[model samples]
Target: MITAIVHIDVEADRIPEVAAQVAELPGVTEAYSTTGDVDIIAVVRVAQHDMLADVIADRVSKVSGVVRTRTYIAFQAYSQHDLEAAFALGLDD
Candidate 1:
């Protein structure tokens, strides 16, 4: 599986609508409105890397208020609780 974190820039007032659209896409596991350089953050999981671009172009970018996007591919991920447990045992080092 491939995981992508997509940062979306949308019209300020339309963030909620855009976020709702993002959440409905097939590959999107989660989407949320956030404060930063981008107005929304979406998590996309796909069966192949090439499909990632298709999801971004066909689904995410097609949303009414979306203006731009920056995608980050995740190499590894850990829950905060796992990280804390590892740190407490000095396993992270």
Candidate 2:
């Protein structure tokens, strides 16, 4: 699986709406409104590298109120145990 951490910038008042839309996308595992340089952060999982672009362009970019996005694709994962722990905690849906 290819994992992506997408940082999204949206209009302040539209943060919740944008986050809800993003979270409903097929490849998006989680989306949260945050207080930082970016308004929302989304985690996406794609079966292939090529599919990542589709998820970003078709799903993420199409969300209303989203101004911009920066996608960070994970290169090397360190520990499966950490991932498992996160899942066990119900962090990733």
Residue-level lDDT of model 2, residues 33-68, one tens digit each, is: 887698999999999999988999887998889889
The stretch of ten residues in a row with the least summed lDDT in candidate 2 is: 84-93
Model 1 C-alpha lDDT per residue in residues 1-93, reported as the tens digit of each score? 999999999999999989998999999999989876879999999999999979998889989999999899999887999788877895454
lDDT of 1 at 4: 96
Could you tell me every candidate's TM-score relative to the true structure?
0.82, 0.82
lDDT of 1 at 13: 91
Clashes by residue pair, model 1: none
Question: How many clashes (backbone N, Cα, C below 3 Å) per candidate?
Answer: 0, 0
Q: RMSD in angstroms, candidate 1?
A: 4.4
For model 1, the superposed segments whose C-alpha errors exceed 4 Å read 80-93
